[model samples]
Target: MTNAEHISEIATLDNVVSPDKVRLLQLLQTQKAAFLAEPYPSYRSRIDDLKRLKAAILASKETLLSALEKDFHYRSHDESLLGDIFSSLSSIDYATKHLRQWMKPQKRHVGVVFQPAKAEVLYQPRGVVGIISPWNYPVFLTIGPLVAAIAAGNRAMIKVSEFTPHTNTVLRHLLGEVFSQDKVCVVHGETDVAQAFSSLPFDHLLFTGSTQVGRHVMKAASENLVSVTLELGGKSPVIIDNNISLDAAVSRFIYGKTMNAGQTCVAPDYIYCPKNRVDELVDAIKTRYLAMYPSIDGCNKRTRVINHRQYTRLQGYLEEASNLGANVIPLGDVASDETSCFMPLTLITGADQSMAVMREEIFGPILPIVAYDNIEQVIASINENSRPLGLYIQSHDKAFQNKVLRETHAGGVCINDAAFHVVVDDLPFGGIGESGMGSYHGVEGFRTFSHAKSLFKRGRICFSDMLFPPYGKKIHDLFYRFFIR
Candidate 1:
């Protein structure tokens, strides 16, 4: 179809839903029946599905970007291309390349007594998988997990966040062109609908969002004993070592924090820097931010906050910190107008545990800088809280980098950079304590949606029969004595 026709189709689909629990069940049942009909899809079939998804993404790239812009009012085009489009396409490509090896049955060792038998593990699909994606980076978060589910030879039902309604419409249209409803479907709804979607008896469920809502998802999933892979957000910390250059550290920090206006789940939540270098670090960040985004008043490249509610929440964080006697610093001279939901890159100094900004996940363009007297203090401070989804450390010194990495815990880490570790296809991306649980990326993702079923086959001559219990004979006694010792 033509581009205009596709756009018209998406606009028609935009008014399609009101978040009915009944529809969620119908979709689940449809996918479950389809999965049962072909429980173990061939490797070639799985590869074909993945290739189709990749093609769909490529074909709908411009439409997806436009929808994202409509949803956020003024989302950065480069951010959408790099973070969402590029990442999803990369994941599909990586999965397709390695799927043949992943689908192969792994040969295992047979014990001495069972020598006549052969053992191996078969990877089987886990039927219908449920995916709950958040609004921030909507396309990537939704499609990323769907790629894993498809790679594992399973059908999926995705529930996109209501906050990004326009993007959801585009996703519905894009996925509809690529997949049958029974094979892959996308649902759009509000909080109540999300709760209903979570409670479904899915073979596996994957959720990506805030820690607060993650708890609710887990609670609802428990009723069906559904396995979950939660990619939740927390206070991801960045440590600037005393030995590193302030300019180098701040440059990396600005890229991570300013991307999506700090709406990233793995975005640097706060900074732990030496007490003396706080001013220098802050100044460097300010200078770098302005160089990139000279004026946020009408800059198209600069992403705005998702909406007024989120914008107000971030503004409240700044106001609360200010009221509590913290030094609130704006990074640029640009003033944000209310119509655009624009929030400038800001710095909160003298921030302590008591301040809301420090206590909560700052999912906006607000950075809190906490001073540390020593390296030991930084380690102690990090350990005291829930492990974050990601940790960033900047230092040319190997010892300092190694020390920070070894002492602290996080789902992922980027040494000398920030938030880039997640895009690496080789690494398994996930969270530890509260940030999240379970991982999905590369081989880890393939295994997450598959069941490793152990298989044993007996030969013509079964050696195990010799040890079958009748009455203990002299040969059995000898065998037991030799093996037990």
Candidate 2:
């Protein structure tokens, strides 16, 4: 089918709701109750199933890449493969290898007031989970949570981004072939359908998108009081102390800033460097940018702005900053063809906190440089805004790095690195404060989609009879001594 046809199908909400939605909800509820009754899956069988899914994804690599490209006019095939397919496979492998340990019942200590009973924590699957993914990285955003949801033994309904019609269609087709719709379903639609999907009273809801939209999703989920995990975007900051190697710092910063054309949530939105190092860092970044994308004029490998709307928004930001007396430097010359797909990597200096580029999350190939003289000033700057989704600090001094990590609050921190922290399976990836709420990925992801039920198993002894309603002087004395004290 053509892109226009697929988009038309998604835009019309009346035809989007399949009978599968009701069937899947029922099946998921039944399965959840059964799993909770038993509370365990056959270890060997679970491992085998995960392995099968991993292999299936690997085999569909080429198809996934092609669909993603057709959806986004210029998404790099290599980027989709590496950032989405490879990451999803790695998450599944990590969960499979460590499922046994994560599933083990955790023993809890009983307080002195309670005797003849043992307490433990049982991680049981929430009946059904809803995943609302964004178009920027459709595969990873969908499969990343699915890896955790399945590992936790829960059914899921994934709502793919409407912006990526081709990718969404391809994913729905692929997933339908692999798993029964009742076990794993996919929903495709535009904004209205997506809003309805989020409003569904699922056991858990996971949303990845901008903060403004995340708020709407949360408000809708409030109708059912559904627990939600929001992975929203923010203006993540990068601080460079004078102690680091300028060359290494510049390379890492530029690579992360420009990757995926800077559509990443954790992309370094703005940088804070020592006042004296500002010029030096700017020069270094320019040198590294040229080296990376030598001919920015017609570079196909470098990603393009996703759509005209996004392109216009970015252009507005650039124009506004220039009007506000900020120096906007185009990293490389614009292509001769005005309609060229490329957007030159831009660096904006002299930007103040009041500027739109500084206030809003810049999900484009634009980088802003801010200068600070003291550590306290930098920390204050970060604290003044909504806590970012992620924070990056580059300093050779261990004390300074630790101070930044300890004093500042962010969803995640990557010391001496850019966004690499999210890939670690052992670490929880999510935001705090305005950036977002809840964490996921690896064991944390499993827990996010599951509820930790506390179970207390008591022996056949009725030791509590002494404290029954017929309170006597002796019972009151005992209670006072043990409970009050």
Backbone clash count for every predicted candidate, in the order shown: 0, 0
**Which of the numbered candidates is closest to the native, going by highest lDDT?**
1
Q: What's the TM-score of every candidate structure? A: 0.94, 0.90
Backbone clashes (count) for model 2: 0
Model 2: what TM-score? 0.90
Local error of candidate 1 at 31, Å?
1.2
Q: Which lDDT tens digits does candidate 2 get at residues 136-224?
A: 88888888998898888777788888888888877787777666665677887777667778766677899999999999999988876
Against the reference, the lDDT scores of all candidates come to: 0.88, 0.81
Cα lDDT of model 1 by residue, 22-94, tens digit: 5777677788778878999898898888888889899999999999999999898899999999999999999
The candidate 1 region of ten consecutive residues with least summed lDDT is: 2-11
Give the true-structure RMSD of model 2.
5.8
